[model samples]
Target: MNNVKSLNKWANAHTYLPVDLLRMALGVFLFMKGVYFFSNIQYLVDLLTPIDKIDRIGAGMFLIHYIAPAHLIGGILIFFGLLTRWAIISQLPILICAIIINFMGQMHHQNLLLAILTLAVCIFFLIYGSGKNSADYFFKMQK
Candidate 1:
């Protein structure tokens, strides 16, 4: 699509080291969150219990299954800057739901802040794409 091309061009022209570091940090943070969630399944279940109450379709169960794996894979893709936008796209819904759950679920201050921060970083990368130091740029150059 024209929009994707334009976005790529814009991102390519604006690559910076700070942005790249931020991207890597975001990736590591996400990966760690995934590991934490996977290891502490009961913690996640307890957090989502309230949302499950609102929806009788057992969507929370599905989310419990989906979130950890998505974060793990998406985090790796993002760290390597491979298919950057798509990786971010996969994470968008999860991040949005995280923010919402923080409000409607356990209401933990630290969790809410972290979710907000991660969501903000994700939105930035969704728009910025991977930078010149990324696998995306390397592959683009190969082509």
Candidate 2:
């Protein structure tokens, strides 16, 4: 009886806010990228122009895999509050490079906005974390 009560207490306490907020924010960014991909493939192609010299076909294929799917998966993980820290860590490099690309390409204000927002949120997740509301907690629970 006491064990049941303790378990219930743990479950009740599982509900928290920070993780939800991060999840929502991450979802928005991911959704935005998918929208952007479908709407402005040409713009992305232009932004990715630098890689063209390496191998045009390969660059296109790489972008299709790297840029499009990553956002989708990242968003999903965040939405489900699973592996969120790892998700953020995985996403940081792409986003940071995007910011660099935009700055170099002189893209514009909006181009920088998502990058900045993603970087800020990822940094927060890296620090304070999502507490017990993530797969990160599951791993820690084992230890």
Estimated TM-score for each candidate? 0.92, 0.69
Q: What residue runs in model 1 are displaced by over 4 Å at the alpha carbon?
A: none
Clashing pairs in model 1?
none
Model 1 weakest lDDT span, ten residues long: 49-58
User: Top model by lDDT, which number?
Assistant: 1
Q: How well is each residue in 30-111 modelled by candidate 2, as lDDT tens digits?
A: 7677677767778767776655453545657576567766777877776665776677777887888888878666676886
State each model's CA lDDT, in order.
0.86, 0.68
Q: Which ranges in model 2 have alpha carbons more than 4 Å from their true place?
A: 1-19, 38-40, 50-57, 133-143
Worst 10 residues of 2 by lDDT: 3-12
lDDT of 1 at 4: 78
Best by TM-score: 1
The local lDDT score (0 to 100) that residue 34 gets in candidate 2 is 64
